[model samples]
Each structure stands twice: as structure tokens, then as C-alpha cells.
Target: MNLTYLPLFYDLSSREQRDALNELMARNPAIQLIDNILEQIQELVRVLFPSETIGEENLKQRVEVYLQNVDLATYGTWVYYPWLEKIVHLLNEEDFIRVRTSRNMYKIDQKEIATLGKKKIGVLGLSVGQSVALTLAMERTCGEIRLADFDHVELSNMNRLRCSITDLGINKAILAARQIAELDPYIKVRCYTDGATEDNLDDLLLVGGKLDLLVEECDGINMKILSRLKAKEFQIPVLMDTNDSGMLDMERFDLEPDRPILHGRLKVLEGLSSIAIAEQLRNLSFPEKIKYLSEMIGIENVSDAMKRSLPEMNKTIVGWPQLASSVMLGGAMITDVARRVLLGQLQSSGRFFVEFADLINDDPDKDFCRS
Candidate 1:
């Protein structure tokens, strides 16, 4: 253990550092195996000192010296991944976060990155929401995340979701959390397999400090409005990406606690009970649902494709079309907006359209060459 070489672990006593190293090595055989030590050292040296080339002889000398003085116990310990019904040994949190997110520096910056790590964000749906949740984790945008998705992964979900066939039937929330754990075990992920509802809304929003922001991507129409209602009550900002025509809806309830829900869409929905709203949306014809959706995002801003899909819903198609492109775009879009919103950089909220059609068509700097 050369304290000078690994300054980050200098705070720990020799015994503690040895224990951490041993624990880490135990789980990672490549690090523990004598035959692989040189290779490991070479890789580490490359990553640590990319600009300075240390030859194999020098690398071995460095690694041997470091290993000789470093005697730690328990390289890793098993963590029960309840969702997958398995226990697995994982790397310690600090080491994991450090190495995994080391490349995200300067671009994310220290100030906003620090702010993001302290914020606890909640994701209510895991279909397209899974993309948002995982993107958030991948970016190290939040230290703790609450995922609430009742649906299990089905065959159809694989079309748009970044999941394998082996994961079919697992709860979406748990799946998302497991993926997050794999990416950054340091991130605190809490899953609600039952999904966010009236019974658990309070716990989801207020538990472990009221959520800094809530990303509502649930399919339940009533839950969408209801979650916003609760978010407004608690003064938490909400971000939702429709995954249709690149629509991103933002509600800055934290800024204006009394801000109208869905931007005051469908005023007829004002007095309707949640149960009534749910029932209405559930049974509405495709045209009716489109009408409601139009109100939510504003009819003028709605995409032509989105408007056209309503007629086919429950007819030629069992549900509206969802593309992997749109879903992934939604994830990136919402995560960026969520990051800005969480950092208080984005002060106002409204609907934003990032549709490819409009963007390329209206490009002011583009010149078309007619063939």
C-alpha cells in the first residue's frame, strides 16, 4: 500500500485498506490471481498514467511493490439482489463510483455533478421510463433513485426497451434498479414493484427526504395527473417524456406550488375524481383519448404522427406505437432537463418539441442541393 501512489485510500489505516483490497480481490479473481497480476497492473498503469508510458518491467516492479505491502481481507461481499433472486459480491461504493464515473468529469463539472449526486429522483414508469432511469444512473446524475413500476417485462417490451430475453417477466422497477446497480453500485436505488399509487404515493414522494424531482412516465392517465398533484403539493418538479414525437413536458411545482396540472389541460378534468378520470381515460375511444392528449400537450404542438396514431389504437394496433429511437431520445432529453432543473438552471417549465421533422426542416443554416 503506497500511500503516495493511491492517495484516495490514504485516509484508511493499513489494516482497513488491506481489508478493502482483499475484499475487492476476492470477488475479482483477475486481480487476485498471481498469473494475471501483471496484466492487471499494466491496465491500471495505463489508466492512471495515460500520458507517461511505463514499460512492462517498470509496471511489474510497481505492481509487485504495491501488492507486497498491501495485504487486505475480503475483496468483495455478496449483496442480495432481491429482484433477481440472487446474491452477488460487489465492489465498494467509493471505488466503484470513482472509476466508473471518472470520465464524466469537466463536462458534467464538479459543481453540478455534486448537486446531482445529492438529489434524490423518482421514476414512476419503467417502459420508456426505464431509459430515463438508466440514463440518469449512467450519467451519475443522482446518488439515490426511487423506481416505481408495477409492470413486468413482457415479450413486447423488448422491442423498445434495452433488455434481454433472459429478463422477461421480471418487474420493470427491479430490472431498472439491477441495471443501475451494475453500472454504479454506489447509487442508492429503491424499487417499488407495486408501482406508485394512492397507497404508496406519500411514501414514494416523502420517504428519505421529499424527492428533489419526480420523472412521471407512467401509462396510467390518472396516475400522471395524480402524481403531478402530489408533486405540486410537495413542491417537487416533475418531468415527463411522452416518447411520442419527442415531447417533453415539465412542471416546475417547486417554483410555483400552485402551477396548474398538465398546464391546465382539459379544464373538464378539474373536478373529476382520480377514480373518475381513470375510468374515463380507460374507456375513452381512440379519438377521445387523442382529444385528452391534445389538451395535455396542446393541440397545436402535437405531432401529426401522434394525432394519426389515435385512430389506429385498439384497432389495427393494440396500442400506440413506441420506437426505440423515440424512447432513447426521451431518456436523454428528460435526463438533461432533469439535470438542469435539479440544479436550478432551468427556471420555467412548459412543453418542448425536439421532433426531428421540424428540426431538420427549419434548419436556418442548411442549403439544399437539388439533384
Candidate 2:
């Protein structure tokens, strides 16, 4: 497989060069804020390799030689795009390269924000959904994003949505689009000033050539239902990370042809009771969770029956202490799942909740109600 990856060993690789750059940034954080960042990266790459096809094993030695006496102020930024160069120049060099957990993680690298070239994401529900979108933007992950929302930003949303005083009264989708473009001019944004629905959901999910992922955080119960179905029908995994009183629901759906049915409409077609089956499926999961459901309903393979009934595979968080605690657990776990998905790791298809609170009492982090 042509692994779509930043070759880890590539140090005398981009990995090592990032470390050298990180060292410089560590010493001087407030470096021009925008242009200095890229300038430094270019400087490290040039100094380490000097030529494009330089030997891989010798990169570290060359980098160590270049840093014998380094000067950040003298670096130039002509190689990287002007917009990225400008944005990077504004940061304190040190702050830009700091890794979150350094002790165990083998590589301490400043991830090139996902949108260096161009990528798009279709996000629903601007409230918590906005959080996911902004987090992506802040990291400079995607190149383009299509934001859909029918609601306007209101005072209540200030509790969780990312917006400022000046952004009030604007439609949530448009507002989110503006935030993304503003944070990084390199980002090209499209807004669905209209709300999302089954009618237009197809256009949004299948549009823009490639939707890296679809994040569902919408409040409309039916729209939420449609979003998941469309994601499955389109073979796009859907990610829903939410916070309730204290727990976070992290659902994963990998559109599968081997499953039962994709959505309720099929059940309606089959003359099978969807509401009843959905209620049943919603309470079952893997054999274990299925067993848990069986214990409750007095039957085995409950979820398997539901899955056999449903026929598709797809993948898909939130909290409070009763909400706060779940929120923390959900938020934390979703990142783990997302990284796995982004990196092509194994993740089961279905709903998952990280009941963090159970840790103190000895219950495992696995608990479920399926559908």
C-alpha cells in the first residue's frame, strides 16, 4: 500500500527536521507570529538535505551540523505559500511546536495542519459541531469545508459554540464558514445557509469531490437520523461526539453491505416494524452488548437479529459529570477513535460510550444501547 503518510523514519526525515525546528521554537516562541514559522521549516529542510534526493540515513548528521550555530532571524519564507507563511510568522516559535504528551509518544512533531493542499468536511449542527469544525481549522487540517446549518447563532449557543460577540445573529453554517476562512485564508469554505434535510443531504455528502469525513452534531432528531443513513448509503463513516449531563456518546458507523438494513424506510418497505426493531437494535451491540440486551429482554443475538434486519455498515460524542464526566470521557475517546480512523486503525461498527465515571467504581469503560 502506498501509505498516505509522512514517512516516520524520513528524519534526516521531515520528522527529524521538525524536531530541529521544534528546538529552535522552544527557545524563541514569539517569533514574528506568522511568517517565521514556515521560514524556519524551510530553513531546517534546506539545511538538513541541501538537495531533494539526499540520502535518508545521513539527514540527522546534516541537521546536527546545521544547528551547530543556528539563527532563526535570518531564515527566509519564500518556499512556502505566502498565506501559510504569514499565518505561521505570527506564532511564538516555541508554542507552535510543543507536543501535548511527550513522555511516551515516540515522535514529537508539529503536524502539518490537514489542509495544506485541499480537503473538505461537511459538518452538521453548528453548536458542538462547530467545536469539531473549529478544532479542525485551528489545527489547519482541511483545505476546504462545507458547513450546513439552518439555525442562527443565539445567546444559548455561546455556552458551547465557537463565536465572538461580533458574530451574533449570523446563520450558524455561514458563521462557521467565516471563522474557518478567517483563521486560515488558505481554507476555501462553502456554506449551506439553508438547514440540512434528507432532500439536500445527498448534495452535501456527495458533493465537493471528496468529503474527508462527516461530523454529526445536529439537534434535529430526524435530520440526525437522515445524516447517519446518508453517510451509510454513501459509504462515508459518520462521527457523532456529544456531551450530555456527564457522559459522551462516541458512535462509529462503517457503511457495510453485509449488515441487515440501512435505515427505517426499508423496514417500512419490508412491513417489519421499524420503531420496534430500531428500539430493539438501539439496545444491542457486539455479542457482549447483545448479551447484555438479551439479559434485559430475555433473548440472545438480539443485536445480530437487529443487524440482520438493518443491512448496512457505517460508523459514527458528549458529556456532563453526570454530563461533565461523560463529556470529558466522550471528548477524550472520540479523539482516540478519530486518530484510528484517520490512520486506518481497526474500530468496530456501532455505538460506544466511555462511561469514565465507572472507572472509580470498577465498571469497565464499555457500556451500550444499540441501533
Candidate whose lDDT is highest: 1
Question: How does model 1 fare in lDDT?
Answer: 0.75
Cα distance off (Å), candidate 2, residue 42: 8.7
lDDT of 1 by residue, 37-129 (tens): 234344544556657778877777766765575533243333443334333444345444544666777677767777788999999999999
TM-score versus the correct structure, for each prediction: 0.79, 0.52
lDDT of 2 by residue, 103-158 (tens): 21232123422222244567787766676676666544455667788888776556
Cα deviation of 324 in candidate 2 (Å)? 8.2
List candidate 1 stretches off by more than 4 Å.
1-68, 72-91, 271-289, 361-365, 368-371
Model 2 regions lying over 4 Å from their true place: 1-119, 245-255, 258-335, 360-371
Worst 10 residues of 2 by lDDT: 1-10
Error of 1 at 132 (Å): 0.4
Instruction: List per-prediction Cα lDDT, in the order shown.
Output: 0.75, 0.49
